[model samples]
Target chain A: MPLRTLLQADDVRRAITRMAHELVEHDPDADRLLLLGIPTRGAVLARRLAAEVARIAGREVPVGVLDVTLYRDDLGTQPTRATGRTDVPADVDGATVVLVDDVLFSGRTVRAALDAVTALGRPAVVRLAVLVDRGHRELPIRPDSVGRNLPSAKSERVRVLLTETDGRDEVTIE
Target chain B: MSDHLLSTRDLSRDAAVALLDVAEDMADTQRRTVKKLPTLRGTTVVNLFFEDSTRTRISFEAAAKRLSADVITFSAKGSSVSKGESLQDTAQTLQAMGADGIVIRHQASGAAAVLATSGWTRAAVVNAGDGTHEHPTQALLDAFTIRKRRFGAGSRGRDLAGLDVVIVGDVLHSRVARSNVWLLTTLGATVRLVAPPTLLPTHIESWPVEAGTDLDAAIADGPDVVMMLRVQRERMTEAFFPSAREYAALYGLSAARADRLRADALVMHPGPMNRGLEIAGSVADSPRSTVLEQVENGIAVRMAVLYDVLAGERTA
Candidate 1:
């Protein structure tokens, strides 16, 4: 299929709600749980997730944007990319940090995000969360919470569209 | 962005804005507790300074180090250049030692342009400052500071359009003023230069600025920014002006002149300030002054320039 909608708007909403509930269940205290979203679509998803978690746990969780462009390993080999805003709301010292992203592919972005987080401050724990996890393991990285795991070949392209950024909310593969 | 940053005139509007935007991001990284990035790891940058500028050299070295690049500062005072070593021999030596980038500040005009265009080395070239030619990074940092003050947090992707800026003092020997004139006008800001008649360049009519000898008129116009350029006392071999007191009275941003400016108008000086000659001591240390901010932003702007030139592979 040239274009196929894997997750509709309602499905994406439900996935975020479920992930927020799972996060609340994991950290009921909700004291040191911080959600950091990667830039672009991931930052939007992070805001939505933080709001949901606040509603469920009856406490607001700190949310920040983590742009890993400068920490990437391929900067020297590939074209230099524009950096995004890396705003850590509060200190990450001794806090449980969760990196939120839209899609996880080669795992390199997450690797870079990890490097960026360590540079910011030493966190007590670190976890990964993604809306979609396509199977293409270039590095030893696995998500702690995945909204959907879609098995696809390396040649296919996966896209995550958020209403805040792309005027819609859905997951597509082509 | 080009491989070398020789002049702001070479940068289009979009390219200049992009550089400023990147500098904003670099400034954000600098505010963090850990201010180092691994973007330029394993890359070697040689600060090839032919003139004695400790501040600019330190700023470039700090920018390089913050990006995790190894920096080798080569000052010409005691180096091989003092022994009459030519630029070609020095560049060849740097190339043989595998220099990835060279930030050069020379005493002759077009020195940076020649080094960049010539085939002495394959490294990226950045002109720190040339003989009254252009200091591109200094202009970039000044633009960065102006945009930040004008737009505040909403500074990214924004140009200094519709802003009126008045630059006062020695225009003949100011590379900072030259670079700022070209870059700021390109960014859509209106620039006015005020200096003594002798200090103003003879080709002032050809530039895209309003040049005048009346600092009072420029200040009375209620410009949004008033930038006082440092009067180069050392470069004044002949009589550029009658006396320091006369120059200060005619052109300095004195208390009366500062009082005439708009309350919110920014006061800027690319310093090593002649506290009483070009700008009053109280004016330089005023709340509206951005001298220290300009210095702080210099590292960020230089980091952006270094990253732009050195991060990507050379594309000849």
Candidate 2:
């Protein structure tokens, strides 16, 4: 049950800023872009990313929360957790959707999120963005925008704490 | 979490509250353009009814479908059950066909309990309504509606502490009343059961509720919710009440009785109502009536129940 701080508050801020710049560079059209955060910390990270995007592009990007709990494939296999709210602000039809998450591990979460997003509406393109990519991906999915690529053992758990929910901004390993 | 929702008595305070909170999330899903969830996509849910029902059956069906589960509806009439096939045989057949969940409504009390405890089926058993024993889902939805009406969006993680609820009409044959009395009380609501002597159950003293024969007296208490149970005329082969007109005069939620209620007091009905028999048409359709809300919440509540029983971790 030991906890060690992996990324400090300043590191998270800098990583987000860099990711925002990369997103702007990759896609100049901010109007057709929508950032949907996976629930829990993913949602908080999405809001932060949206703010960062607004700061860089000077245009507000629509952000929504996508709960992948119900869309998960391993529902009954692993004890199913309660589902969070899925709120998509705009019609996703023909829009580039960047699925945001705090951590990227097995890629199963992103896969579930993709299913959830597609069920909402047919997007022109769907992209993946993560604050941290900790490898050990069981699925063939990769993040387009990654804040950090911290390789670690599969036995270890990466915990991302945000000020919105956890009252602190830091990444930890336990 | 239990694997089956057979009775409200099996629900702990925390479990009951958790189910309600999950239902709130389900309700939130209803507002979205894509109301379907992928949670139960590969899962199969069978609506197994050994009795006739419209609302409860449809509510469970809608709930299962919304969760993206394949739903197969089985009615007793025109089915193998009408050919004198037993409940165990039918349940085993469903199990063999790979049903992950069974939402059952039966004419006999304790049928759901038997299906849940017996090893005939491995699927999670959700009692839509089992005779007059209990309709746990109905009570859950009723509680959800009441909590939503009283607390609005702040109802999450909240219990009905210090709330007053009065259940009226044919208590002798009402699974809704039995379930509500147990669940509402468990959620910290003080319940008062009002029915005529003939309509009230003989063993009412054992129930965890204040029992009374005077509807006016109970209404005078200004309860937070007034739930009217349907008067099953078909069930009453012998005269339970002297006449429908006399019952309406004494116990029916007339417009006058509705006016006597506090402005905040909500009216409820487990429907297929005998309009003028147990409740007045005006009162049933009144602004305070959560009748329609109950029907709507029924889907969300059943979804929560199905989720908790089938997908949730078995903690107990």
Candidate 3:
């Protein structure tokens, strides 16, 4: 595993700040922006995005988590540990949805998450955000916002760490 | 553990209802006299039974055939299960040959739960009946029957909110009773468990139902539905009560007890009834008795379940 410091913790915050402003500009009215974090690391980013969106828009944005365990197309290969509970406070019907995931790899997780979110309610539009973008996508998926890009092998892992969960914002190789 | 339908608690509230909804789609196949679909067309559905079941196995076979799925019926006396191959090994073998789903019935509880969630994720698992644990599809059918009977054409979009359900007889070892308790409660119906103290499970408090030992007191509450569970001869052997006649005299739905219920209150039983034990033959045959309707509803409800789990309504 290569110790590549592509983006420092501070650099990641600035990127999020820019991304948050871009999202606000994309939807000017932005009355109720909904954020759904994919399980584990994505949840941390979802909450952070919500806070950042609030700082820029002068209002608290509603955020939640989506557990896509049952929706996984290729199940049983990975340890399907339940990370935490998902809470959808606002009805996603006709709302702009920003689905946050930690790292984009095969794009299957995002695919499953999209299906699960759709069952909750019909979102007007769905967009994806990633902390780190790792290539080799099995699906035609492109992230709308990215904190940084990491070049990696399939066997290696790009683990996302944040102060909300791991007490420090960093990306580690495993 | 052997794979079987033990309880509804094994299912989440969402999954249970989704299974019921799916069963509805399967029921539609009956409209065609041919009664077959192409969903499980090439897949094999094996019914491995450890206990005697006429309607349950047949109902499942009917369900599989309706789905155009291959059916293999296994008997305890004839199969390797009797020769002592572990259920895990057998399930893995079924997986190898491509069994899309395994509909199993066993004498042990929690068998279905273990199989469905266990590492063998290739096949969809349906629990037919497992020991004193659950008969899920049966309960779903009962609910479907109740909904259709009570609400009619408009029952499709409605959820049972205030329906009073009284379950009478042996709650001790009846898997049907166990399944109904959870499913009914999850669906927002008020469930009353009426049985002898010795017949109630130790964890009855954990169940979201009104539990009492007196049948008269339970029905006196005026439940919209009165379901008499089959008091198995198996329970008599365990000494849950003194005698069948005595139990019937005190707890059974006689001509007099049937009058105690609301006139519209539907009488039900997961059948093969000990008529003289938990319920009188007269009450079971009464027009209000939905015992037969339950059987008819069983097919539709099961079809709905098979389709729901496979259709990926919740999973998709």
Model 2 lDDT per residue over A1-174, tens place: 598999999999999999888888888864699999998888988899999999999989999999888777777766658767677788899998999999999999999988888877799889888999999999999899999999988999999999899998999998
The CAPRI class of candidate 3 is incorrect
TM-score of chain A of each: 0.96, 0.96, 0.90
Q: After superposition, which runs of candidate 3 have C-alpha atoms over 4 Å from their true positions?
A: A1-174, B1-7, B10-18, B235-237, B311-316
* Residues forming the 10-long window of minimal summed lDDT in candidate 1 chain B: B307-316
After aligning candidate 3 to the native by TM-score, how far in Å is the CA of B274 from where it should be? 1.1
lDDT of 3 by residue, A1-174 (tens): 566555668877886787777778878786878989987889888888889989989998999987665456653333222223456778888988999998999999998787767766688889898888888899998888877778888988778778888888877765
- Residues B94-145 of candidate 2: C-alpha lDDT, one tens digit per residue: 9999998899999889999899889898888998888889999999999999
**Candidate 1 structure quality by residue, lDDT tens digits, B197-228:** 89889888889999998888888889999999
lDDT of 3 by residue, B1-316 (tens): 1132346676665555555554444444354333554444555777877777989999888877776679988777767887898778878878887776688888888787777877764677788988887888888898888887888755654556799999888888888898888888888899988888888889877788888878788878889998888878764566888877788887788989898888898998888887777778898889999989888878877666554444332231
> What is residue B278's positional error in candidate 1, in angstroms?
1.0
Give me the displacement of residue B276 in model 3, in angstroms.
1.9
State model 2's lDDT: 0.89
DockQ score, prediction 3: 0.02
Which ranking of candidates, highest TM-score first?
1, 2, 3
After superposition, which runs of candidate 1 have C-alpha atoms over 4 Å from their true positions? Answer: none
Global lDDT scores for all candidate models: 0.91, 0.89, 0.76
